[model samples]
Target: MISAAGLLVQQRALAGRDYRLIGHSGARAAFSLGRWRIALEVLLWAVLALVLAAPLLALVASSLVPAYGVPLNFNTISLSAYAEILFRQSITLTALKNSLILASAAALGLLTVTVPAAYLLTRRKGALANLIAILIEIPYALPGIVLAVAFILTFAAPLPVVGLSLYGTIWIILAAYFSSFLAVSLKPVLSAFLQMDPALEEAARLAGAGFFRRMRDVLLPLVAPAAGASVILVFLIAANELTVSALLWSAGTQTLGVAIFNLDDSGSSDLASALSVLVVILVIALMAALEYLAKHLPEGVLPWRN
Candidate 1:
């Protein structure tokens, strides 16, 4: 009834359809599992995004509004609050300056203290080393308020030799920051040390490199990425910290945290909201920078990256 060529073409078409329709049961099950996992992953991401973004969006919206009770609308939105923070508030500027200075100092100081200490701890392991490590971490393990109180008590009195009281001073805050965050700053560097190859340092030592020379030429270069991470981490934490600074801040030494708290406490929620928005911007920028640097950094340097 049909030509041979037409019969052959019809048979080929049916074969193609059969091939498309047919698949192993295992393959179908795998595809279903893959789709399910993707859906779950997407759902998790959505929840996380909502949780993180809601408060930030609320703060930004509040900052844009002129008053606390005013709803965000076309007529209510204003930039006056931001202007007040930037132009009218000298206290805000002073707090920003002090926070920057203290954070920078703390980061540098932590790097100076933690790098060598990490190297020593990694190179030498003994009961004494373990004890020292625990002692160093003890303050950080304690609550920040406890450490703040301890600092206040310890430095409230004038030093016998210098006769200078550090309490109620920026120095006292710095001291507290150092004690509270030293362990935090040490973590990345210590991880770096654990991952580093000892043969490289040993090779340098055998080749007439002295302690300082080997450290400079061999060890520092390897550990630099982690050190950078430590500095940034400490800087961010110290800059935005409230708990320790709240207790230690004197009249002139009010930090950003104290400033924000004071602004809210004084019933100037609008100004506080504006300042908080700026702080959120700053934190976002720093995190973005860190994310950008994550590719260049060591694997474990960023705890959240993985």
Candidate 2:
């Protein structure tokens, strides 16, 4: 039989007390959250260090050791393995040269085709463009083994007109690299094209600038960073690529991937490890160079930067 007004007042008092209590505890809650965030960041960094640095350290250590089953330490380390790979191994040098050539060629080829193709795709919107995009993505989406099989089957026989066979040749490997990496090379350029304003081109057109002129003056400058990114990405992938190269390489055309596999397969694990260390060093150098170059690039050009 309490009065309604009294009940209302009591509820209000309870609410006010609850609000004051929350206000008092808010700082503690914030402090707890901050500690948790710091802890999480530290944990994440630790995991990354383990995942990335541990293997690299182990590789370097192994490469320095004289033989397999030998414990690696500063005192046990020697430069003999390095000297052997660099000076003595002819096939290693060949593999390195081939990898460099293939990677460089692939990067340039990818950029040449993808820049115009991406621009065309971005400019033209239709079912055809969509269909073509899907087609381009298919090879990249499929496993490397599948693509290798397809290439082998298609090129196993001599061409109908030229009577030329590309199977088990460097050309076949290059073709596979193109097919597998085309989509990757196109994505950044396409993204850049999509993000660009049409008004720039229209203004150039108003100035009587032709297609090539407009592309040179406006579009190329705008998308140069993306193009650079594409080149770097495609180069890295093609250089380090294994599965396709392993399947397609001939005796004289053996790439670094094939060389590495062959060395390990032949039970030259020490030599393989040594070669692998060099490859890792090369990869790290490239990535570091890219990172340094990114400062001069357009804001969104390097995907890993942001």
Candidate 3:
């Protein structure tokens, strides 16, 4: 307590000294510090973005070159490398189909499960809501590999419970994604729900609308931003899903990512690089779209709702 009092006294003395000595000059110094901080922040962001993007740029340049070397120019760029994989075979097509299918399914599944889950969760309060929130966030704690192993073990049961065997199928992949992404998807949605007024929902119910009708009309329009954000997040995760899909994929169920790994394993550098570029381009497109959507989206009630 004495130390605290002494610190307080020191702060007051320093403030008094500054005010008496510098007078109005302190305001200029404070503004200078703020500008310095802003400049530093902008510079830091530029450096970080460059650091992350440098390797991807190198990959693109390398993939476009007919011969792989340490040249820092695009003079040797050729479309043949791109053409070789995209036009050369059917497996890339198959992989593309699989990736689209998997990502779409994962996004839809996340929407199906998390929307209702987030809405209903708003009904609870205090400890129950906190517990559910924690539970929803548990997936972020588990590594992808751990989740994959757990999923395989849990669903690999061969006892034929009611004629369902989830041991070896694409459904396992879908389930793994649903388990992993539901938490991230729910956070945005739940935040939206918390900001939304309960009266809108109550009005729907009072007007003789069923639960589905209310969700379809009232809640969904408000939560559309969150839903779109969740879909994009889930799709990106599903498209690049490597660890679980790699472990779980069998002979006939190889995703595009798994197929790329297979090409790398088989020393098919050309094909791997080609697919890598393709995947990168596709990701870029998706991210661009998401960014555009996020910017133009009608601000949802959640952010500044009363």
Candidate 4:
């Protein structure tokens, strides 16, 4: 009954209507998806605030209070606890010093061992290298408590030649640290080496560059960022180490972690909390510094970075 012209007009009208419906449906879907995304983001932040931020705030509040049972308020807040731990307490100062030394030494010591070892393992890739890599990782894979026990058994006896005992000394703790965190330090350096192009080293070698010169000039520069990252990571972990030191510490060898435990055990929770707050501050500062350096470093050098 319709003319051709009329049929075209009807078809165009229906097509326009369908286009409008499709657009409306698409808009609705987009809006729904955006709302869900926003909701999920909010939920994630809420969970982080509840789980992480709340506890940290509570810890800060606890550290500010003058006494353990006292409520934290403008009037009740005091820095006396911090002063007591920082100045009045010899034990705390000693622990802090010991922790700093141990952290620095462990970081530097591990770097010396891991850099060459990583290079060799990555370059050679033989059965011996594989076995050695496994050995390096074994101590780290073991639980801290188990590692501590093993170290105690191994070092309980005095040295054969020198007859020196390392059972209850800072040296033993350092040794344990070396054993446990070797893998931590090795991983980043090894990753760096693996990602490196061997041709650069070979080119230098062809140009009459000796081993030391090649490492100093070419390899070290390339892997320095990773090495630095390894140092920072190891230092952070070693500074707050607990398990190994708990078993191996002696009178003068108490570390920051042990000191905190001791303070709490002695009913000095305020002091303990104050010390913990300082440690938290230190850790945050270090993390922020590391994050800042992330841009300069290689892609996977820092673990927390992408």
Question: Which one is best on lDDT?
Answer: 4
lDDT of each: 0.84, 0.81, 0.73, 0.85
Candidate 2, residues 142-223, lDDT tens digits: the string is 7898889889998999989999999877889999999999988997788778667677789999999999999999999988
How many clashing residue pairs, candidate 2? 0
RMSD of every candidate to native, in Å, equals 18.1, 14.8, 11.0, 17.0
Worst 10 residues of 4 by lDDT: 16-25
* Per-model TM values vs. the true structure: 0.86, 0.85, 0.75, 0.87
TM-score-superior candidate, 2 or 4: 4
List candidate 2 stretches off by more than 4 Å. 1-33, 296-303
TM-score of 2: 0.85
Clashes of 3: 0
Q: What shift in Å separates residue 260 of candidate 1 from its native position after superposition?
A: 0.8
Model 1 lowest lDDT segment of ten: 16-25
Q: Candidate 3 clashing pairs?
A: none
Candidate 4, residue 245: how far the Cα is off, in Å: 0.8
In TM-score terms, which candidate is top? 4
How well is each residue in 222-259 modelled by candidate 3, as lDDT tens digits? Answer: 88887887788778768987888887777666788898
